[model samples]
Target: MYYKEYGNTGMKVSAIGLGTMRYDEQDVKAGRFEKCAEIPLYALENGINYWDTAPFYCDDKSEIITGIALSQVKRSDVYVTSKTNFSTLGDHPSRDDFRRRLETSLDRLKTDYIDFYHMWCMLNLESWERHMEVLYSFFEEAEREGLIRNIVFSSHMQGDDIETVVETGKFKGMLIGYNALNHRFRQSGIEKAYENGMGVVVMNPLGGGMIPNHPEAFTYLTEGTDLTVPQAALRFVASHKEITVTLAGCTTKEHIDDAVKAVENLEEYSAQEIVKQFEGKGASLNNLCTGCGYCKGCPKEIEIPKYMDAYNQYIFTGKKKSILDRLDNHWDISKEKVLECIACRKCEEQCTQHLPIVERLKEIGEIS
Candidate 1:
């Protein structure tokens, strides 16, 4: 129920935004998007006013499911955010192509206009420049045409580079990956965005389910508090004055309730205090893969995210059986696929966390 100003844009967004990327896999695979659609509807009814989706999220059904939910609500009641990624838009997208993409998103979201449209998945200055050269003016045109209210971007780059992006003064907002494990790494960019009067939304607030899945590994974040580890993680991002929203990739109604509950009573904590609290914990988590799936496009056709997620199980429990169980039951990736990684390091190059992915694959391949 808590809301904050989205910068000086005169829009107040929910402190806990609903992210549509983590809808139930079975529902998506079985073409039961109506079941997936209900979660966003439930979230909107329950006080979440911000809904973020994209074309490819949830097996390319997120925007459709989001559209289904938005249809039942008054359009002005919620702020809708979607993205246009370079991977999808291609290297030389024309203005007409950009307009087409926007119109397609409008159709999928069941809205005539988007509240916020992002320069999705920006990785470095090179990519930022490329987008600016090829598509920034088109984004400006869309804003002027009332197709989108704000032009924003999402990034996984470090703070300094992101600060440079903010300095361009081209965006109205930004969504970045920030959590207890990596906030320090991206804090400067967040502060820069705030200083530039740009709205800052924190994605991957639960470290892409890492913090909740391994609560014991992050007890320091909740020590001396009545909050659960997930609650603590949510609070850590929401408590920041610079942050406009902390997005939780909620799949169930309970997840929505839990996310809403986590921010009900936010305490003002100093950034340094949070940093100091998590000072020594970096070694355990800085290298942890968040399952963001940016590491796709493997030349060998390996499902890198699945193996990295399985590796996470091994990291937590130190049991080969744990990794095997995750690959078999949850991911459906076989050990043979794990062994297929040819050390091309292509995935590692694209990885947001720059994890030792090939080495991890080697270790997984040697298992049993």
Candidate 2:
């Protein structure tokens, strides 16, 4: 397996890190710990040393099963990453509760310390501000007590929130949403973090399993080569020199094999070239928003990005039910938001892609 310098952390992480989110659902459902454990164990044998898991992944069995797997391997052979949701911060998280949570993770992983601990699901600056004072104290204490090697955060917010959080320079790393469809909006903050020498681990690099299904849509990434769509997508991310880890949340060995082969055969390509190709052909050139977030602060509090993502989903896969389900269930974006648009052209005016925001809203209303 290939390795890359994990930014200022000074760790040589496997370029193909293992994300243990989908660890054999069938095996897990059957209560076959051994079968599920084989997944990470197989990944280790394949030279993927950066094993990432969380308490929430795999129906809250990820950390437990991953811990069981880690116990069999030499502790030093892997760098462990885990996260805490802490979305319940309004319940008033005491430091002891926080430490207990960390200790519980360490206990489950069968390791004394986590290599990277992420403040999971960090959205905007306001959300962080709500927990800043408490989190800062807990982070320092966790480090001083050797519970974590470095403090990091994971965010899905591609708006001004990401840049605001990264510029503080308080984190050792960040895990943000990065993929072919989403990169344009997050690039600025990603570069800023890289500039500060912080490790950047990208989640949703496969567009949350959207790319592989629409392989034909991304033939442009192959660029006159015979690379498959997923291969092109993974290689495209590695082509960005600033990116430290392009996360593959694989559930199957086949999935790992695909990503491994993609990275193994990675050929440098121009991101601009790929994007330009998408703008014209080789990808769906529907009324797509680049996720620029210029249409943010909607007066009606509409989640325009969620709307655009759903549109892109339909355009990419030609699956109307999946698109509607994603917008409704996965993204939690209400179709009812269309009623709140107020016929405002404000979002259109601020759009860099100049997509038809009002028209899309009308179409979204007709999604049923």
Candidate 3:
């Protein structure tokens, strides 16, 4: 229940926030509402006041469950965060689409105003700029009309986007994909956000469950620490000076309990020690692909990074079928696209993170 100042907003948020992404599982054959409702309620009773959810998660069912669970708690005692998928905010989203989506979200959540509203899944500079205009306008109107209290965005973009957004000085918070496996923010983006007075909220603090004790991807820290895989991962993110809260999307009460225990006994570790812990054991971000598909426009029409991303997701999250299913559904990519990497070294040159793209792609094709 430790609290931290949420940026300069003067609001003290819990160091551990509740993430609702796991509430609605498409794979579950049974109903989830009864069990899902308890996770938030238990979290709230234990002092976790920050709740993060999104419309894209489980097709908005996560938000609906979140709202229902939070209804039992006083609104003033909790902060609810939800996001809109900006990919749908097309060149010109129709008034109906915009209004319908917003209204639907509010209704589903059963809340008059959301504590924080974000533009979700922002990946590139072009998408960021295009959606910023729409998002700022929407938030401005919502604030004036009392529909939302704060503005924010969640990004999987690089340092440049982080700098641009923070410099705007409009958003109250920024959710970044950060964890032991993905430390891009710590390199510079996180510092930039802090410099511009923006609150940093960390998503995927477990590298999408990769920080846990997976036989293939387990880091040295996982083997040496007294903490469990999840504990080490959560603690690593929570220990960061820049992060206000580390969000964990818990599916079961057991998941919630483990996370709560980790945060309750959370220790402050030096950055050097944390870095040393993950020095080896296949946890480095050296050859990782984020599945962003930014390198897909190559003349060769290769599905370069996505395959690697899927492989990582499978190994880390233990959601092999789910990742494969997503790739199978979303992209009309061919087997050749997945298997025909020539190692021309073209993709390696274009990667922003300077990852060994060709090698990773080859590994992915072989592994998945």
- For lDDT, the strongest prediction is 1
lDDT of 1 by residue, 1-368 (tens): 88889987999998899999999999989989889999988998878899999988888999999999898899999999999966778778888888888899999998999999999988878888898889888999989989999999999888999999999999999999999877878899998999899999999988887888778887777777788999888988998888999999988899998888888867655566667766776444667789888898998999888888898887778798898899889988788887777788888778888789999898888888
Clashes of each: 0, 0, 0
Candidate 2's residue-wise lDDT over 1-368, tens digit each?
77777778789887777888888788878878777878788888888888888876777788888899899999888888998745533347888878778888889898999999988766656667766666777977888888899998887666467778888888989888777766777777777887788888877677655677667766677887666888778877876766777877777778788778777745444445545545655443424554546578788888887887787777656776666887878798778878788877777765544578888788878777
- Which whole-number lDDT from 0 to 100 does residue 64 have in model 2? 87
Clash pairs for candidate 3 = none
What TM-score goes with each of the models?
Answer: 0.88, 0.79, 0.78
Quick one: best TM-score, which candidate? 1
Off by over 4 Å in 3: 24-32, 94-96, 184-186, 213-219, 222-225, 267-283, 290-306, 309-368
- Candidate 1: 10-residue stretch with minimal lDDT: 265-274
Better of 1 and 3 by lDDT: 1
Please give the CA lDDT of all the candidate structures.
0.87, 0.76, 0.70
After superposing candidate 1 on the true structure, give the runs of residues whose Cα lies further than 4 Å from its correct spot. Answer: 29-35, 277-284, 306-343, 359-368
Judged by lDDT against the true structure, how good is candidate 1?
Answer: 0.87
* lDDT over C-alpha atoms for residue 92 of model 1: 86
What's the true lDDT of residue 313 in model 1? 85
